[model samples]
Target: MTKSRPNILLIYTGGTIGMVKDFETGALKAFDFKNLLDRIPELKHLDCDIETFSFAEPIDSSNMNPKYWVEIAEIIESNYNLFDGFVVLHGSDTMSYTASALSFMLEHLAKPVVFTGSQLPIGDLRTDAKENLITSIHVASLQHFNEPVIKEVTLYFEYKLYRANRTTKINAEHFEAFASLNYPDLVTSGVHLKVNTDYLFKPNTKKRFKVNKNFDTNIALVKLYPGISEALLRAVFSTFGLKGVILESYGAGNCTTETWFLNILKEAILNGIQIINVTQCSGGSVLMGQYQSSELLLKLGIISGKDMTTEAAVCKLMYLLGQNVSSKVFKTIYETSLRGELT
Candidate 1:
């Protein structure tokens, strides 16, 4: 039997949630997390022992990258047995990417790992930080039959809990900073915290928590647009040494049937680079070959990212590439939903 007091590790990566107001000038700035408990007095009341570790110099969410993903994974890996759960405070900008990457990096996780951040500074009067921070910890510490309840990566925002990889930041200015258009909420908070058990992911208890820290971020996103020129297309496809491409195409994943564009994509795929076709519009799946333009992509062996958000597609590609998996096996893994990251 486990102790009633759950042990949670709070990883504070730079973001709005950790910011506070400068007492005299009233300027909102990142707070020193050394005094985190003093800042949030309510944490003491929870039935959990919380320990925090902040970055030496906090970085804005925009600067988040694959390196940081590996760092976070290492922290969890080193302290896996000590903590019952982990809650990460991150910026909303790249929170989905980090969450998604973590989902793949931390394999066979049998405890909750919830990522959350707020739109406003924590020290402000009407900041959304209070609720987001508190609720994330609550969700992290949740248990059933004396074991952790949620055993996967998750994002909690605006009173809703969603699978980490399935989420996308939809609103920048609003309190509801994210939405999982490809998937349903894992839990919703109202009169009582409701857990959608049917939609939740159950880990393979048979496998060990294998961490893949080597993620390759050598990827690009190409959104198809009308009147896209040959020079522009050629430059994008040839400019850098790209390992993968997330092609955000028109409805149903259609693109121009131009010979030049077709050849560029075919050459890339033949060179063993992955090209994932995802829909540009919300609430739809990418159906390759459903139209003439997209047929070119299908013929060239491009992979259909059916119902995957651009965020998920990009992060998943990076995660897969990090494993140094062969092109054939990479396709098999990308199209397969390993952690409920895709439909």
Candidate 2:
């Protein structure tokens, strides 16, 4: 008996990883993905049948939003049955955001959805795109007992594979551009691929796979700074149709205990604006009520975001708001880890 090769789909959403330099103009341009296999001949040697799909037009990651997030989810849903795994080539700028969004969007996802990109263009002499792309596909194709090994959305960069919702883009100029400070890396690539199987997500295979395309963008993310004024907080709460706010607070989700600041947040919670307290630090959990300052947040019924990155918290808020969960349980639901995003 012999094993069969996996069928991996390469989706080029947009990124510097798939660009080629135009020598005459000295500017990088998006290359024709139809020639993807030609540029990366090494892909032919992988034990998988590869197919490529490109968006009609590439988008810069800075402009990434919920609309594009829905588009990506639909693509995966439509092709779910045909492919064993998916590798999304996306810009590193918002790769963590997109990865986090998809983790919440896909329900009962039993196959790998790996996202990867490079800091430098593919045509660069010292490009990192080839390694990232090749390894991502290989990771997506891993199997055990004729079943997929990675059953969650993941972001692969430089040489590490992280749970998508646990990742944060920590650097803009380095090859090792992403980090999982509060969580462990799912996979690490070196001389041999070392998978931390204990940390992998396992989905309920009995349930049918479903795609969640609806995402409400009526959300605000505000960071707490010294001497922050009331007017700015008022402006955010006053935004028409604003449904949620992800408040990035100081260490352990603490903020100024001033009466004015507390009143504004209390008012928002009363007015049905879901306010979440996530820590500003990159490497810790939000432990509301652990200190006197954060005790006020716990008393105000502010939802704790725990260990989730700001990128993940933002997407999770939008996703949950779109689901229209009632205020009575919204706080409880957000505090729970729907996608292993928080502790």
Best by TM-score: 2
Task: Write candidate 2's Cα lDDT for 1-343 as tens digits.
Answer: 6667889988998989989898789999998878878988998888898998998988988888889998899999999999999999999999999999999999999999999999989888899998999999999999888789999999999899999999998998989999999999999999999999999997899999999888898999999999999888888888998889999999989999889899999999888999988999988999999999999999999999998899999999999998988899998999898888988
- Clash-forming residue pairs, model 1: none
lDDT, candidate 1, 1-343, per-residue tens: 5566898999998998888889899787878777877989898888888899898888899999888998999999999999999999999999999999899889999999999999999988999999889889988998888888899999999999999988888898999889988788998977678999999889997888888888787888999889888888777778577889899999999998888888899888887789899999976898888888788888888888988888888888988888888986777778888888777
Stretches > 4 Å off in candidate 1: none
Find the number of clashing residue pairs for candidate 1.
0
TM-score for predicted model 1 compared with the true structure: 0.96
Q: Each candidate's TM vs. the true structure?
A: 0.96, 0.98
RMSD of each: 1.4, 1.0
